[model samples]
Target: MKTSECMLCPRQCGVDRSVKFGFCGESEEIRIARAAPHMWEEPPISGTKGSGTVFFSGCNLRCIYCQNHEIAVSHLGYAVTADKLLRIFFDLQAQGVHNINLVTAGHFAHQLIPILRQAKADGLRIPILWNSSGYESADTIRMLEGLIDIYLPDFKYINPKTAKEYSNAPDYPETAKASLAEMVRQVGAPQFDSQTGLMTRGVQVRHLVLPGHAQESRQILWYLFQTYGNGIGYSIMNQYTPMPQMKDHPLLSRKVTAQEYENVIRYAKQIGIENAYTQEGEAACESFIPKFSGQPQ
Candidate 1:
């Protein structure tokens, strides 16, 4: 399919992606950094087995301290056709994974629709999870309503200033809120498979606590708890390791302190957020980074 004026994300960089790259540095074709069984997800999603993860290349919001900068910013990956992606999904399913996780896949939503449809038709009976950066448009999210079984989105920042400083998107907070609301609307609450302890359908909001940004993480959790109540699951992340290039950037130059993470976890408990997942000490080890070894077929 030809890439028309690309407005898939809120960036709306109307570049002719058919012939050239857009602001996300991706065209109509789907480029993936990896496709493997990832065991690092939440307990319900990953379970004793793994989450079949497809790490898509490029991103709508290129955060300066992103852990996946190799794929998100540099766009270091191989392109794959929709049919090949379908095969990869089935292959992962055969590996005894609980679900198919699409990581950072917002930019390639249009291309994924067909693959998802075919996978469903072929009796690919695992939950399809859309893991995103949360800078999505409500309209774009609505388009994936039935196709997506779960929404794993980041409610990164409550302050626009922090968002713009880190991600170059001043409206990230507002847009992410609206987008998450739509996600919750589509997948109302967390439903698990009793036999396997796997998540079947739900909206899981993730917030990575940055160093010196504990208050911001608290504010984001407050907004989510107040808005969605106990209907949503939350992953309070403490795995904020400063990437190599962020050494000179003020707040991005260091890892989040134990005190910062403790404060956020304390606030989460105070707010009565029962269904939550948190990281322990030294969870930000580079060993957590998944290898981008999978290539297109």
Candidate 2:
């Protein structure tokens, strides 16, 4: 199948990606940055083993403070056929991962459908997680209704102005709200395996507490709790690191303050949001960034 003028995401960058690359720097082919067992995800998603992570290259929203800017903005990666991607999945499965995680795959949605179908047919029994930035279109999400088993989406911003300043996308908050509603509609609530503690099917909403954005984080959590009402899982993250390019931005130049993260967590408890996960002070350390030096077959 050919890639359309590719308004797959909210970007709607009408550059005929079938012939040439769009604003995302990728064409019809699937470009991957890394394929390996990632252990740094949330407890249920990562478990005692690991999550089979396939980090796709290019992104619709290039946030200035993005940690994975190498793959997200710079497009530092190579293209691989769907067949090769399936092979990598099977290889990772053999390595004993709990689930297959597809990170930042919104731009390449059409291309991933067939690849996932083939992997499912070839004895890929683990749950498939659609991990993405919250900037998604409802129509694009509807296309993935039954294919995705777990939804791990980030609710980046509560206000459009903050989104525009940080990610150059003014519609981030609106798009994310609609897209997350669709995700919840598809996967009703968080379901887990009793013995393994691994997630089976659910929508886990992640909110990274940005420095100087504690109020925004509180609003986002309140919105999520009000909308989903314990039907969704929440992972409150505190791993915001200042990348080189963010040194000039006033808010993005430092790590999230302890008070900022604490306030959000406190708000979550006040709202009676029980199924929430949080990190401590040491989580701000840069030791979490995984080495993307390709996966062993």
Candidate 3:
């Protein structure tokens, strides 16, 4: 869990983070791009009040088609201490948010445990959600056992070859599998607040249906249904908007076709994954992406 020779993620880029930055382009400092309430998440997570979201800068597996490329590729956030982070949690709690959502905190999971504990001690209510890229170490997830109430992780790719070609992580599938198991073990079945319709505990697998890869998406749906059954939620995303930088790239140069999205959805029905969320028309747009430059208002 030491970032001095950072190994929190599967990358294990031992870079003595006290002196140098790791593969996540961050040192010991906690740099966050945005800290505010986000309503763009799934129904239960966003609810009516919206989830108190904090977007962290830098990422372990920055795919070629990353929607949050600005924050994922650069340091565009304010550096805050553990104490300050706890204060942010308290501030958001006062705003009457549905939950405290920690976006992409794996790189800083080493420092969050104590802060979360202290915040809860200081009367921080509401569920604690960990929104992740799913390329996490099981040990890292284990460290956050009771502290994290909900898990929102992406099951990006089922094939190692696709993972390697897209995100440069050949070990993504296996690594994510282990991480998911740990998360499920921590919170057994998916449980939601009956009155509020907010998720209290459970792991939700978010699989973005990539263009020209609907079959792979189908495969991932089948795997999730077979493995977790209806105990977990699956969000089939159609929000793969092609960024301007990818205008000349090989496969990421176009948006995910409507046919491709439908194909994936058809397969989901075949697998009986009724406990899933699917997108509708015109979801692959840049309007959904939040600005990651400074303090979000």
Candidate 4:
């Protein structure tokens, strides 16, 4: 998390983040696209209230079919100082949120760690969730050990060909696996509050089912069950919206059919994956992707 030389993610694209931009297309300054109560998460994280979500701009991996393409690719967000970021957390905590969720923050880890530590010292009582793309370095994750209470990372792909084609990361399968193991080691196991139904500590691995990739999705499910064995919660997401930018692309042009989603879900049950989550009908629409301008801007 140093500004002098950037090695936050596995890419290790060394550049003075303060002067030159790295692979993530980010400078030293902290940029945030959204700060609000986001309810579009798991039941434990969102509960009756919502997860205090802070969506950081830019990303380590540039997934071609990303729903948050506006911020991930174009970096459509406003700049904020460390103090301002803390205020945002306070504001959300005042709104009775379940936890402080940091989304897509792998690129800005340098600027965020201190802010998170200060927030914790200043009575930021809610559990802190590290929501990431799962293309992370074990060193970077180990640095945030106790500071992060919940690890919500996406296990995107098992096939190197698919990873290279979509995310441009050929080592996604191994990288994500090691990252998940480290995350599970830190958090131990899933723990939830009885009355609040909020997740206090755990690792929740999310996988967005892509169109024409049901076989890979099933392999990812088996990998999770075999490796972690119910130590992490599996959330199978079928909410892949075909964004406008990928209209001409090959696989990203279409929506995931009900059969595709069902095929993956059915495989999870067959493989004895009981600790999991799945989406209902009509979740592959654009209504779920929030605007980049965000609220109360």
Location of the lowest summed lDDT over 10 successive residues in candidate 2: 288-297
The CA lDDT of each predicted structure is: 0.89, 0.89, 0.88, 0.89
Clash number for model 2? 0
Instruction: State the weakest 10-residue window (summed lDDT) of model 3.
Output: 288-297
Q: Per-residue CA lDDT of candidate 1, range 1-297, in tens?
A: 555887889999887777878878898878999999889999999998899999999888988888988888787899888888888999999999999999989888887877888899999999999999999988889989899999999899999999999899999989999999999899989999889778999999899998888888989999999998889999999888888998898777888888889999999999999999999887888789886754553
In Å, residue 66's CA in model 2 sits off its true spot by 0.8
- Stretches of candidate 1 above 4 Å error? 294-297
Task: Give me the displacement of residue 136 in model 2, in angstroms.
Answer: 0.9
Candidate 2 achieves a global lDDT of: 0.89
TM-score of 1: 0.97
Q: Give each prediction's root-mean-square deviation over alpha carbons.
A: 1.2, 1.3, 1.3, 1.3
User: For candidate 2, what is the TM-score?
Assistant: 0.97
Task: State the local distance difference test value for candidate 1.
Answer: 0.89
Cα TM-score per model: 0.97, 0.97, 0.97, 0.97
Task: Output the TM-score of candidate 3.
Answer: 0.97
Per-residue alpha-carbon lDDT of candidate 4 for residues 221-258, written as tens digits (9 for 90 to 100): 98899988878888999999888888998877898899
